[model samples]
Target: MSDAPSAPHLSRRVWIMIGAAAAIVTLSMGIRQAFGLFLAPLALDMGIDRQTFGLVVAIQNLLFGLAQPFVGALADRRGAGTIAVAGALIYALGLVVAGLASNALGLGLGLGVLTGAAMSGAAFVVVLGAVGKVVPAHKRTLAFGLVTAGGSLGQFLIVPLAQGLIDAFDWRVTLFVLAALVALVIPLALGVAGKPPAANHTDGPALKPALAEAFAHPSFWMLNFGFFVCGFQLAFVGFHLPAYLRDGGLSPSVGATALALIGLFNIAGSWLWGAWGSKRSKKGLLALLYALRGLSMIVFILVPLSPASALVFAAVSGFLWLGTLPLTNGLVAQIYGLRHLSALAGIVFLSHQVGAFLGAWLAGLTFDATGSYMLMWIVSIALALTAAVANLPIKEAPLVRSALPAE
Candidate 1:
């Protein structure tokens, strides 16, 4: 052959959609991750104890998780744009309320329920679902990686930015500023709405039958259980690590840096998982990652506490942090197909959030009672190891196609 046919090129519209998705993800996650930087400051400002603050965050995680399925459903039915816009507005309001909060109720309503619900609408599930529709199947993993990495970049960039704001002005001002920033997500989300993509099989089997099929799969249960542990470990550390570092006599800057490091390194970690998932068995990689998380936690606990050590722990642990997200989400797409992925992924995510509730709440309860986080640390490691073992047995395969109606 004299010349091979030239490859087709993606239009400007597709690139614009990709950019919008990335921007939405970055803004949403940046605001969500910035909440950790405010935990202690907000608590102290409101004259509440750490446990009280932890409980609010715990509720947020719970509600966030609980709201996912419903939100995903809405997005699937109404389109992702409407859901994203509503979430952005609610998120903005949540920040505003948190800025003026003077009691636990305000915090709970503003930071917990409102923000949680908003996050449900604006989370990775929705963002990645949109990406799945736009990107080619062969390049989907890379697209997913870019979106996940954008969230990590948000965390990396926003934590320090929020901290700097807090330092330069006040926490209240920082909250208001962040609220203003969150409002920007509304426009970005608009790009994701409209017709479902060719790759997206939105009118597939009924939701009930799909759920039934997933429930019958042994690997699905394994993946669900494994995901629960991921939630437990990550939420526990994310919500409480700042407070724990403070307790250990570290400065607020150290805590912020730790969170930033986790975000920074997680950018690499998520990309690594995306690349690896494209090449290897995702389940096996998941198991190895969980094992590494457990090992990292063990080493962190064993070492004497110090800012240097905390940073080191953050850098190492960060690599294993949200790395689980891309793999877990990819597994859902691979196993269930994209037809009902938002709903199925949302359900699995609910379990993860339940674990998050436990992790965040229990850390506070145990710490309040014993004045030590050592036990929580141990539990996290144990859960990670258990997840590693659990994931080892999961079998990943495509779902059996059914002639059932769309739910």
Candidate 2:
């Protein structure tokens, strides 16, 4: 056999590309997470009920999910930078519009549609897709973990910053400031400039046929279904937890602190899961994480409501938050090659957003009807348990092509 170099050095440009991709994820997710802080203030300013605000946020989550698959496909075909830049512009516009909005329609259009569409383009799938292509196979897991951790850091850093801004200035001013910050992501997107050319092969399956193949896989469906529950649990708490705490007689500072803690702790949790997933059975670990999340929710709901309880819940729940992301994305990359990862992961994320829509909307409905969020908490727990069970049986083997003679 001819000998060739076994390992290659990563260039400075590749490191820069990775950093750019991580920053894009950080800014995009940071802005999205900060939206929760605005829920109460936006509703109060527009003279709308909590349900009205909840509905718009629900619409946002749904639209984000709906847009993701298409965005992912486009990013896979085109360069991620093009999509990232466009998404940054739209995200900035959304924040500005939300700041200027005088009615629910404007809020929905700005905060819901524009921001959601922008997020779809700039989300983790697109970033991870680029990173997967550039980073070596051995280092991909660690790279993805670092990028995901950046996002968690953004959430932790931006929320408290947003809260402080709101305290010092008006929420509208805070939004405009955020819009300006989001605009900076455009230049960062430019750093992910180069992408590999598509391989030319006459025997290769068409994109649609390949997608169909993925759809028929039992493991794919299991992952998709389980991710749906993940979205529901996370979105419900992200959007409503602050409001829930207020209803329980806690202060705004307490709510902000709780959110910050979740973000902060998730940084550690996501990295740990990513490292562990690389070494062990990702599916089994994912199942256990989901089960623990369900148990945590049950305990939080069953216990007495107090500031101390809320903080304890936040600390516990934060450890589980976003830990699912690394494993879920890693599985997608493992089963399918990184070549089609963005599109496949986007489809899975779409299911997640559908659950998010239901979770956010139903929480509002339940609260409006009974003036209590206890029932929704119970529903979240049940969904988590279902997700845990669904994940348990997923086959972790990579897809294999049938043996055939080359044409």
Q: Which candidate tops lDDT?
A: 2
- lDDT string for model 1 (1-407, tens) is 11322222556776676667777878888778877777767766778776777788889889989999877766665667878888899999998998898888988899888998898887787777766656665556656766787788888888899999998998889989999988988888877877565433443466677788889888888888888898888788987898899998999899999999998998888777776776678899999999999998999888899999999999988888877877888888787777676788888888888888888889988988999999999999888899999998777777656465332
Tell me the whole-model lDDT of each prediction, alpha carbons only.
0.81, 0.82
Q: For model 1, what is the C-alpha lDDT against the true structure?
A: 0.81
Model 1 clash pairs are 206-405, 206-407
Instruction: Tell me the tens digit of each residue's lDDT in model 2 across 25-105.
Output: 778887778777887887667786778777888888899999988898888788789888888899899999989999999
Error of 2 at 235 (Å): 0.8
Backbone clash total for model 2 is 0
Segments of candidate 2 deviating more than 4 angstroms: 1-11, 200-204, 403-407
